[model samples]
Target: MQRFRLADLAPAPWRNGGGVTREIARGALDGATDWDWRLSVARIAHDGPFSTFSGVDRVATLVDGAVRLESATQTQAWTTPGEAHGFAGETAFTARLDGGGARFFNVMVRRGRLVATVVAHRTSGVLAPAQDVQHGLLVLHGRFAVETPAGTERLEAEDGLLWAGARPALRATLDTPTGCLVEVRLSAPAQTDGAA
Candidate 1:
């Protein structure tokens, strides 16, 4: 279990230079051109086309502001916060800001190696980890007290908790009236033996 504060991370310039992105976590950090999986938050400041990642699967959730995504065959309106929109990384898309700018959380995984899901949950109670899966909880709004075998942590907006490897028991209590939680679940890839 690890806790990450959003403010502590420095933003990196995006490949397209339309905005900046803050990488929260990645499967490999050895300066590789390709990684198995990655989680990040990006700030969209202007309307532009997204950078294409040929063989990656992407899931994006709106955290602040409003925007509409236009692809070749589809257009998606993201007005509600915490709602996730998924698309193929290879798809070319343009974004139009409803107001001015927007902040979004993104999860990308290499095709055929892993699968992922991002969902919003509004509740207060125990959140047990799923079997053979990685869990990442992003606090979108309000405050929370998360308890686990490691320890208890106080999380605020933009704060996240990552639990990988062995699934552990976790309990979360809302500190405010209502809060939004972005639950990220990643399926573990199958092990391959050097054969054939």
Candidate 2:
């Protein structure tokens, strides 16, 4: 269990200079950039084509401001905070701000290798992750108390935790009336090759 402040992540300029991205966490078979799955936040600073990821699928959730994204086959406008959109990483879409600028939380999973789900949860009790499961929880609103093997700690909005292997019994409790969080749950799918 690792703690992070979303607003404090260091941003790296995009190769095309159209945006900046802050990687929250990633998992790779070889522990390198060739990620099996990745979680990140990106600032769409200008109008440019969304980069393509050959064997990946993506989910982008609007965090702040608004933007309109278009591709040859589809156009998506993110006008509301928390609105989420899913697409093939090879869609070749372009994005332009609908307002001032925009920020989004993104999840990308390598095709046929893993499965992922992103959802918003109004939390109040234990946020327990199975020992073999991977989870990312970003506090969208309110405060929380995270209990882990290390100790209990407090977290507020824009704070999060990325968790994976060698897990411990953990608990996360909402500190306010109602707290909302974006939950990214990743898991491996059962093999279908019939070689098991």
Number of the top-ranking candidate, with TM-score as the measure? 1
lDDT per residue for candidate 2 within 102-130, as digits (tens), equals: 88899999988777878776666665556
lDDT of the candidates, in the order given: 0.84, 0.80
Where in model 2 is the C-alpha error above 4 Å?
30-33, 131-133, 148-150, 166-172, 176-179, 193-196
TM-score of each: 0.89, 0.83
Determine the backbone clash count of candidate 2. 0
lDDT per residue (tens digit) for residues 1-196 in model 1: 8789888989999877788999998884235576878889999989999777898999999889999889879998888789898889998989899978998899998887778878787777777667644668899888888888768888899999887765666788889898888888888666779898
**Candidate 1, superposed: residue stretches over 4 Å from native:** 28-33, 189-196
User: In candidate 1, which residue pairs get closer than 3 Å at backbone N, Cα or C atoms, i.e. clash?
Assistant: none
